[model samples]
Target chain A: MTVYSNCHVITFNYRQSGIMERIYLDNNATTIVDPAVRDTMEPFYCHMYGNPNSLHLFGIEVRPYLHQAMEQLYSGIGASDADDIIINSCATEGNNTVILGFYFNLLKDTRKKHIITTQLEHPCVRESCRFLERHGVKVTYLAPDRDGLITAKMVKDAITDQTALVSVMWANNETGIILPIEEISKVCKEQGVYLHSDAVQAIGKVKVDLQKVRVDFLTFSAHKFHGPKGVGGLYIRDGLNLPPLLHGGEQMGGHRAGTVNVAGTVAMGKAIELANASLDFENREVRRLRDKLEDALLKNADVLVVGKRELRTPNTLYVSIRGVEGESMIWDLNQNGIAASTGSACASESLEASPILTAIGADRELAHTGVRFSLSRFTTEKEIDITIEVANKAIERLRQLSTSY
Target chain B: MAKSDLIGGELWEQYSQRVADRMNNPRNFGELTESDAQKLGGRLVIADEGAESCGDTVRLFWIVDEKTNIIKKATFKSFGCGTAIAATDMMAEMCIGRTVDEAAKITNLEVEHALRDQEDVAAVPPQKMHCSVMAYEVIKRATSIYRNVDISTLAETDIVCECARVSLQTIEDAIRINDLKTVQEITDYTKAGAFCKSCIQPGGHEKRDIYIVDILARVRAEIERERNPHRTLSAEFAKLSVIKQFKAIESVLDEHIRPVLARDGGGIELEDIQPGENGIINVHIRYQGSCKGCAGNVAGTLSFVEQTLQKNLSENIRGVVV
Candidate 1:
């Protein structure tokens, strides 16, 4: 059949559809800035550009936006009060602040120089705990089981009377496995040790109620949802005192200093609002697309899905194809205008295998070949179909080309 | 629409068009089979190189004519990032039609420059520069195999950061280009100090002759000397008599090395100094007490004393146990 009627048809089709069509499946890395959030933040760049720290009208006008953002975050995350939210940079910085803040406060008490965390935490928390270890603070990194789930009993067994704080991630970035935060929190509470949960990957993907979880602190970034980057927040329990992480002018009640990022805060508020509104659709439609993509890819004998037996984020599907290299598969997918990521950072010049995958007892070969496809509410059934087809073809080509196979 | 803003604005923009082109269509991918290798007189050389920090590995194959020493074909199979693939592909392509000796001269810079679509632009980002170095190493390895020499003997350049694959020359270049004044900036630009960080200073997971800190200080001093050429104190010190150098070395050892060695009931004595070939000062030493039979005396304490003397006294000092 004559697929191309003329040169104009070819040019138009290529311009309008072929190269223009992009299938993004790496939402765990970062999400696209939402149009609604961008619209909400647009006016702040010039028209509403004012320092919230200033006392003049320009600053006074922007203060309300920051307050609104705080309120939105507190309500969205199910915090007890808006005053407990400390807005800062990305989730990494938020995690660092809370971790270091806890450590700094406990420094005076030599008896409490120990911290407990999981091995599958995002690199930020893991690195923070390592830094503490380097500075003479004892740390225990609890590795997850085969399903990428860290048990509450593991935390309880690891915690000693000397433990000062316990930090665990609500959801893992690579495997999408959800840890038992409530159970871990209860154990921490019985032991009288502070508990913090890095909810960066869980805030929008799953429901997080501070009332139910009873975590002493929670950390998340806005960009994990549809908000802009450079904005994250930390939730501290009311009546708990944390030393200021950032020292300067009095800001956030002397907890963190530096002028507030007004537009980013506003966009974060709008994004969280939109995320909460669409939570049902995300758990249903997005989950459906993710499941369909995983099921279709599993038709191949080589394909193995990660965290299948554990609770995971609705939009994330981590899979490893035997004998096919994840880096090569991602490059091939990119050639076909698709976006994805490997679970392991090894292929990208950092020689370490995916600690998360390895922690879950995946062999080196399987860990190296793991690919993570994190979906969003914006993902469509058509995109899922295209992703399945493209990914299968790419995996087949890579497996054939792989010399080790 | 989403092409430009995949990861973010500037981070994704750091990659050039050549990187994308080569990643999608690698020039000389895949290894030659046994029969295919027989076409070039059965002198096919295969070598593998791996980056420790990121488990990326590259395997290179070369078909060399033994009589002519000319490489007829070059191919590679890389399990790594796009930069590694592109760099290895370009490296293999650059090797073909050239003599094995000539191919051995290919540096990571040359591989990167060849992959550049335009002049004076980096083919990859700063962090990905190690990929090019990995390609350069595999070429040396293949050449070593062809020449029937040990790969370590074939390596002429000193590599400081094994994890980042950063050579001494690359580290100096980064310092000079970016005017990197601190170890952090050097790590940011060249990633040398980012991994095991043994290259950061004396105490780390690994050890190197020239740490990133030393390279930074040397480059900065060279810049200062270049700005003011009349400075002659260091040069005069270098030209001092061997006896005078020995005196300085004795003082350094007595002050820094002996006290630490004394803690372990060990001491080091300077026996003689002879000016060896190529301006290398061969200083002979005899270990006393428990140090004479200690394993660390030869392995660890020897380097510690030598490095201490070199840092405090002269760069030409080379300590040898008698």
Candidate 2:
């Protein structure tokens, strides 16, 4: 249901396919699969499909592909070891499992079940904390740097012996500010408390080295790297006894259960392989296009790109188009066959102030009015130009609409 | 839209919610007329706590319940959001279950003390502790009415802005909830507006009804009419003063006296006519849609009008019964 009057909540069905435009800028939400990755997973979807947990040859045949996907995901992020990767349906599930699983262990042990997390963490992490708080767990919300960055010292101060784990996003989903995960992971490491990082936005866009950062857990969405949606991998440091988030049949070696989605695994693996292989090309080209978009918006609209400029992902721009409610501008662009996101889409219904924006000390109006434009490997210069043109119009029009209100 | 829609619309929603809440569960609305309340103050307590101390500066509203028993719901209607609303809503809620005697001694300090640790509960913020002051006052006013005592300045203080509810909590909550930056936005959301008119009984504002003394006026007129007999002129005295009074008033000669007078083809004038010289001011006036210069107007109206004026004004300046 479209819980509010303002939304397109319907799932993509064949009904909309004919009318749907090809250039969708809401890649940060999800993206089209890479052609190379699609070809790689074609066999699994039709012929080689099998439950990897099965003992039969057909099942065994898919296991290698799943393992290969995990390795690519691990290697792509420069993981020191492959066994740390735990495959899951999506980054949200991975984030929940890490946070909840850690809490369960703490609750079970009768240890101090406190968690320290940044206000900038996603709803997957933030809501999980809220849920856990209702369950009698204490949480200390770490503040961000003025530009919405969190330094290692904030993590150091926030953590206590009672702190079961610390979660900080590797890069902000909306702004793409690369947080000081390395320094924060160091703090958590020294404190002997576990650290979980939501690396879904960070992994493919930037360099992440479990080899360097040493977070206890990390989550990545395969779709973020042109993989199939609903297939992600979570990295758990070896020998941390985490409680499983879900249970049923003996699958994922009993860590996670129920039959595996074989096609998802295959496509995820293929997408990761291609993404890893084309890393520099995708990275440089998308960044070039993003710069073009960002520069044009800045030069033309005089907008402030939220978060620090130097330490951000090249494929995304969180522009504060002043004098416009971000959601209205997003809708305006949407009507023009362009796609973008307000800082608070998907969360529009709660109508709650964004904790992230508030944490960053964003001006309340500006926080609510922030818009993000994320680019992917398929994003072209022409696409950037179109977005700028559409954005300028949307911003101007939305500004007018805002005045009437 | 209908008047009901205006009262219930977005314009009035916030105030109505606040008023309803105070009416139902004023934060410090219930009475505390405990035998133990003797320690609170030297009285049978039946209003807000902290009410015994004068100048507590609380803001509260009183509404006569369907019971016709006064319901005092208190809040710092002056205190400004959720805390203000919460205290008002909560007090109103709790007050419903209590008695007039219990509502007094409802103190802000007690409500504040109740809310101090309930950051998790739906209590107003700490900064808005004073709103309980108003909630406290509502209880006292309701108590006074219950006892039939007159309340003046003690009850309705100058409401800062009827629409905004800008008391400490409303302002603070507005500043905090939507993170509103300016006073204007706070006004918009909290509705510290005056646009939505509240037509309270004309009797209530000055604390007296104009209609109540109307009967006494009629009675005094009757006494004067009895006191003075044979008061005014033989119709030959077409007094200019009486004619001027009628002219100054709507031409009853037109509405009530005009037609008959027009038929007479002679008219009255208003020069130096003494009212008592015209007994009860009983000029028998008659009328048509158009005006009348009635010849009998001097006899028609002089006495009854004089008596009516003398009776209503009560001899502000006594005059002849003419």
Candidate 3:
């Protein structure tokens, strides 16, 4: 009877999944696991469940697949075979490891006790810098310009002889503004300081070639590109040694120590391969849909889009619809079976305005009204059309209700 | 996908059915024009209030019958979150068909309760409770405009919780009527200390001489003394020497009042104390620091000082600002 009930539930969900027309535009938060990635990861769960550290035949069979996944990860980020790619749990963990590793390994012994990062960093990087500050490290948080660009000159001006590292994000998660990381990396190289870029938003949507961009450390997550959650990669350049964040078994050459997540690593490998293959489609098709949605939203005079279309990633649209609160707009969108976000999902519950918008010099009122709609390659034109219609209706109704009008 | 699928499963459950329904379709939305008011044989009263904490605002429209003093029609427009819209919708609905005096008596708790799916269940989450308080405030503004009086004249007692409009009299009445003991019970009944929570105790975002903690202690002590009728502390203040009386009053001001004023860069200094007719003790105070030239020193702050002194040291003490 239990098996029968389980089958009934599965059949019910399958039928509902095919018929429901839910529109998802919050891809920057996370993405659905692709069917191809899921298929590639299925065998490691039960059939080939062997600990990669064992010397038995069962473990020997898993070695080639693990090596292949590692190779895929190395090639995906354009890292050479000599460079080390440490697979860990998500970009947040990777970011913490790199920032804290600089303090624990290099800066602790040297006279250089300062680090420079931008105000536009993810909370993980920002809070990690703050944590280091409590431990007697001087940190400079450079603010972005009105265009939401953190220039290379800002990094050069903030750099000093005591500067040990410079960290910046490749693309902002809120405004979709890509920072000038190439020039910043060049400046860091000239200043004899290590450079790290949180390329979580740039890896799948844009072309990120580590060969051309000489960043010392780069981090990315597979889930941002349609892989499973709880798995990501951190790239360390050749001839650089940072102490391990997690200490236990000798895994990933002791750079990061843990039993390998075989299924998640395989899924990430497959997802990155697919993401690389779909780069052209992402630029052409996803960009077109995002532009269409932006054009539709711009028809209203009260709407203000955050960044220029030519400057941002192809999939993100962050806008502030005046006289409508972000949470209220998201509530209306969710009622219509459409998903969106405001600033960050983690900070949405607080009544405080978006810190990102405030950092970009937006007024307090405009900062309270930011709504983000991030697209994926799977987002259809019909979904965009429905979203446009629903969003317009919500704006009109909410504006009529607003006394400011 | 279901609504739970769009929002997370846990957050989706926070919205009650009635709140969601009213947010989607607010029945009492939009304003009444002057011609519409004239058509209903009443005068239009428009009142708007804004919440500085979240930049949410609500504007209320009422057409009061001149002779009968009844609200002929009521509507509102809210520039806020979904919970604000639902709260203002219910607040405006409760005003219609009731006299202006009766409508003015409506509280945020009543508006919040009217939006609930069940009797005991809350309509909105705790963080959104301030939206209903905004709704209740706009009604007071509209009432004051219709009656041609100041909004402050409508409240008979001091405000204990500025965020939720829970006054000292309202909280005391709620505690006495409902037999409330805990601070959570006071919040659940009167919505005091629900938002910001600076009024709950000292060392919060703001300071208050008469915190909910102090009020609970005073009320419980009064209840205990009432049961034991022979016990009294009223004559203790009159029996003290002049120097001891001055020290006693200074100590009470130091412990209870100075911290609240000092938090906002203001303070009060005791100028003099003298005996007045009818057994009254006149305590003269001069504003120091940021309190000088401030308008609240004449009204709210002065009364709060007197009330704190009366509750703590003696009931015969009166505060005089010099």
Candidate 4:
């Protein structure tokens, strides 16, 4: 493995003969697995390969590591020992489980058969609500305000007696605008409704103290926070008694049934530990780099940043250049060894205007032009400088060719 | 930095070198000013078209030499993706020395082909194919402006698939040129019925004036007739008995007409068939379901049924609503 002192600058093996310097700014999509996390996971793969459920001495040796990892996970989010965090696949699975589990466990035959989610949610939550809608569940998709904010009052006004649960994302994946989850959680508690927050984008980037904010359920994926992909955690508030989404073995206390991904769980523990330690770096240096890039982009007359910087996750900068389409900008950036995104990578394949941008009342033309540049703790000032220069040149060339002017 | 050292990986290789070059530094970018046209002793024609799906717009500017009806210069401006820039730049270059009429004949396929570095490799991906189509559309728009005619008269063909901008003439030409057989083949070659599929056949999500299934059948029949040279449609229909003719007309109505009307909560039923004066065969029909007593049954629906029967069965057959 090649190591660079500056973690952001890496030599990527291009399809052609030579190597190219790769600068990653799409960390909100996924992050590179931290070296420490990788080192922690190495032993679990071959050496400590016993199933956590086995009764042999091999399983007995692995119990303490699993217990320590569990403690690390609970402490990362400030969840008390009373609550349960079921390790599962990515946050997409966790989101589906929570949203669907509510319907099957509590809301299916009840008079309260309604779900409330925002229009700006990740597709997992939005699609899960859509799946329930086919089964006679009435879903009210609340639209965000012009500033891309979903207020506590919006949730308060939208809740009906027939509302079974309110599922809101802690931070929007595209815009990175942090929602009022605390106030929304209080409202859900007051109304006696179950609340689930898909905190996949918020866990490592922002402060997520469950002791401070009382939410019934929260879900996060490890990949978004510099851990290996595939493994995620779903926090169930104590005594909730929700039925399992997968129904075979008696793993995760019969809440989730597959054999635990020991390596992935261990890596996730180290990733979260590193994330907590680097929270200050994320808020200061990463935010500074993101702001520097945003300032450079804002020098252009037609660039529109999605949300105010203060309200968004410090590492994120979502901007729309008036004339340049998102994919075109991404293409130009890719050619220059810079990595960025046009909203969620999952939905970018459809080439449709971003639903999050549209939900925030951006015009159709502006919505198609949104490019998100997300920073990570490893991103350096030199990478930011190079990105600013390359992005400026791309925007200028694309604008010169644009008919919008 | 070396050009080959770009970090796009496979996606960079997907685009032709010419496309990559033009996309990065388009030669025919920006519009020609009125003074620029005057210096060339020509008139300026500007036309723009927008893709509603992706919000990409392309505008073409041409300086036409009025005396010879030739294009003195052509340039373009695109508010779209990179492929749109490359496609429009290549289109503009192709139009520079040609006459306005000659430039109007330029197809999206030619523009797409002109950008390819290799013989058979596609210049752009399938999703970006519409960018080249957009370039072709702006040319028609510019031609219409230069000729002072309506844009619709320029193509002289119905747009069969609006999503992909595949015209009936384009589809028919593709079928003839490429020897395309099935609708799937047409979609693969020309991208008609590839998206939304409203124009593939009747009873789709949206109503279409003309369908690809009908075009395929008509063009295939034309090809068949050209090959055989002896089996004439009129002679074949003339040999059928009146009952056979009625059944043929009924089947044509069932296949072509009923499904479209059914979607609108209406239906049609054949009443009778009679030999009118000369070679004319008059087929009587009645409206059913929501179509009964509807004013459209006499006007639009009557002509539609007559046209369907005439096209499928025999040109001598006419429809009279009872």
Regions more than 4 Å wrong, model 4? A1-20, A344-347, B1-13, B162-191, B195-322
Overall lDDT per candidate, in order of appearance: 0.79, 0.58, 0.84, 0.84
TM-score: the better of candidates 2 and 4: 4
* Cα-based TM-score, every candidate: 0.70, 0.54, 0.77, 0.78
Instruction: Kindly give the number of clashing pairs for every candidate.
Output: 5, 87, 0, 0
Q: Give a tens-digit lDDT track for model 2, residues A151-199.
A: 9998898887788888889998878888988888888889988889998
Q: What is the TM-score of chain B in candidate 1?
A: 0.55
Tens digits of per-residue lDDT for model 1, B1-71: 26533543232244566666676667788877667778667577889887554556788988888888888
lDDT of 4 by residue, A79-102 (tens): 999999999998998899999998
By lDDT, is 1 or 4 better? 4
Of 1 and 3, the candidate ranking higher by DockQ: 3
DockQ of each: 0.11, 0.01, 0.19, 0.21
Instruction: Choose the strongest candidate by TM-score.
Output: 4
Candidate 2 chain A lowest-lDDT run of ten = A1-10
TM-score of model 2 (CA atoms) = 0.54
Candidate 3, residues B120-187, lDDT tens digits: the string is 66666555675577888899999999999999998646889866777788988887778778898999
Better of 1 and 3 by lDDT: 3
How far out, in Å, is residue A297 in model 3?
A: 1.3
